[model samples]
Target: MNTADFIKARAAALGFDVCRFASASEPWSAGERLAHFVEAGRHGDMGWMETTLERRAHPTSMWAEAKTAVVLGLNYGPGHDPLPEMGDASAGYISVYARGDDYHEVIKGRLKTLAGQIAARTGEDVKVFVDTAPLMEKPLAQRAGVGWQGKHTNLLSRTRGNWLFLGVILTAAELEPDAPESEHCGACTACLDVCPTQAFPAPFQLDARRCLSYLTIEFAGPWPVEFRKATGSRIYGCDDCLAICPWNKFAVASHESRVQAREGLVSPRLADLAALDDAAFRALFSKSPVKRIGRDRFVRNVLYAIGNSGDADLIEAARALLDDPAPVVRGGAVWALSRLMDDEAFAALRSERAGGEADASVRVEWAADQA
Candidate 1:
C-alpha cells in the first residue's frame, strides 16, 4: 500500500472514526467569517481570538513548514439523549463534551502517538494540536472531509452526527488531500430554534456574549442579567443546539472509555452542587473539563439555575453562598434569591448587601432584584 493508504489504516486502528488530509493553506472563507465575528464583538471577552487572528486564518502561518494537515475526528456520542436531564431542576447539566476526561489530554496523547508512528515510518516532521492551539480545527476538518460546519458552527459528520472531537497533525510532507464534504444542513434550522439564549444572530453564526457556554465558562466577570434566566441549570456548558440536531439519530455511542459519561457527572444534583465548597468542587471535577472554569464560575452557573428552579428547598443553599468571595458567585446568589425567595427573604438579603463590600456589578443585580 502507498504511504497515504498505510496512514489511513493506522488512523482507523488508532480509534479515529474519520481521517482526511488537506493543504496547510489559508482557509480564507472561514477567516472572513471569523473577522466578521470578531468585528461584531461576537466573541465577547474571549480576547485570545482577537490576538491570534492571522495564525487562526492560515495553518501555514502557525507552522511555516507545514505542507500537509491531517484532520482526525473521534466520536463521543452518548448512548442516550442528554437533553431530558436539563429539565430536572434538581440536577445540573454539564455539556456532553466535558462529561468524560478532558479531551485535550485524551486526544492529544493519541495524536502524538500517531504522529510519532508516522514520523518513524516517513521520516517527516510533525506537530499535533487538539483545541489547545490557534488552529481553526472546525474549518480544517471540513476541508479534510471529516464533516461540514453545521449551522451552530460546530463540525458535524454524516456518520457521527455532531458528536466528534477534532485533532490536527501538521507535517512537512505533502499528502494527497481529501475532497471537502458538501454542506448538508439544507433548510433545517433545528439547532438555531433550540438555543436557550438565542446565541445565533444568523444562521451559522454565534454571539458568544449571549451564549450560555461562554457565560458559564469563557466570560470571567458577572454574567449579564438578561441571560441569567435562560442559562437554566447548565453549570458547565450548554448542549441544546447539538442535542436537537436531526442527524443525531445516526450517532452511536463512543467506545473511547475515557470519553464515557461518569455516573455523578451525567446528572449531578443541583442542591449538592450549590453546597460544594472549593475543596469539594476540586475533588469532584479533578481531571475533568469542568475543572477549567474553577470553583467560583461553576458555582455562579449553579446559582443561576437555582434561581430559575423556583424550588424553595434550594433557598438555604443559595443563602449559604451569599457571602461568597467571588462577586460573580454572590451576584448569582442574589439572582437565585430573587427567583426562589419570598418577598421577605429577598428583602433580608437585599439589606445585607447594603453594608457589604459587594462589587458594583453585584450591587446592580441586588438592586434590580429588590426593585
Candidate 2:
C-alpha cells in the first residue's frame, strides 16, 4: 500500500471512523469566509478568532511546511434522535456531542499515536490537532472528502452523517489528496428553521450571539432578555440543527463506548441540576466536556431552564440560588423567579431582594424583569 493508504489503515485501527488526505498547503476560500465572519462581528464573544486570524487563515500559515493534511473523523451519533427529549420542559437538553466525554481528550492521544507512526515511516516533521488549536478542521475534513459542511456550517458526512468529531494531522510529506465532497443540502432548510433563536443569518452563516451553545458554554455573563425565553431547557448546548438533518438517516449508532451519552447527563432534571454545589458538579462531570464551563456557568444555565420549565415546583430551587456566590448564577436566579412567579409575588420578592443586590448585572436583570 502507498503512504496515504497506510495512514488510513492505521487511523482505522486506532478507532477512527474515517480517514482522508488533503493538500494543506493548497489555497482555499475558507480563510476568507472566516475573515468575513469575524469582520462582520458574527463570532460574538469568541475574541480568540480575531486574535489568531493570521495563523488560522490556512494550514501553511501556521506551519509553512504543512504539505498534507490527514483528516480523521470519529462518529459519535446518538443511536436515536435526541430532539424529542426537549419535550420534557422540566429537564435540560444538552447537545449530543457534549453528552459524552470531551472529544478533544478522546481524539488527541490517538492523533498523536498516528502522527508518531507517520513520522517514523516518512521521516517528516508532523503536528497533531484536535479542535483545540487555531487550525480549522472542518474545512480540512471537507477538502479531504471526510464530509461536506452542511448548511448548519458543521461538517456532515454522507456515511457518518452529522455526528462525526474531527481531528487533523499536518505532515511535511505530500500524500495523494482525495476528491473533495460537494454540498448536498439541496434546498433543505431544516437546520435553519429548527434554530430557536434563528442564529443562522443565511443558509451557512451563524451569528454566535444568538446561538444557545455559545451563550451556555462561552459567554460568561447573563444572557439578553430576548434569548432567555428562547433558550427553553437547553442548559449546555443546542443540537436542533444537527439532529434535524436528513443525512442522519444514513448514520449508524457509534460503536465507541466513550462517546456515548452518560445516563446522568441525558435529559437531567432541571431542579436537581439547579441544586448542585460546586463539589457535586465537579464530581458529576468529571472527565466530561460539561465541566469546562465550570459549576457557576453550568448552574446559571440550569436556572434558565428552571424558569422556562413553568413547573413552579422548581421555585424553591431558583429561590435557593438567589444568594449564590456567582453573580451570573444570582442573575439567572432572578430571571427564573421572574418567569415562574406571579406579578404580586415577583414584585414582593423583587422589593425584598433587589435592594441588597450589589452586582450591577444582577441588578439589571431585576430591573429588566420589572419592566
- The candidate maximizing lDDT is 2
lDDT of 2 by residue, 170-193 (tens): 999988999999999999999999
Q: Which one wins on TM-score?
A: 2
Which sections of candidate 1 miss by over 4 Å?
none
**Local lDDT at 19 for model 2:** 90
Off by over 4 Å in 2: none
Clashing pairs in 1: none
Model 2 poorest 10 in a row by lDDT: 362-371
Question: Could you tell me the lDDT of residue 145 within candidate 2?
Answer: 90
The alpha-carbon lDDT assigned to residue 96 of candidate 2 equals 91
RMSD vs true structure, all candidates:
1.5, 1.0
Per-residue lDDT, model 2, residue 58, is 98
TM-scores, all models, native as reference: 0.96, 0.98
Angstrom error of the Cα, residue 369, model 2: value is 3.0
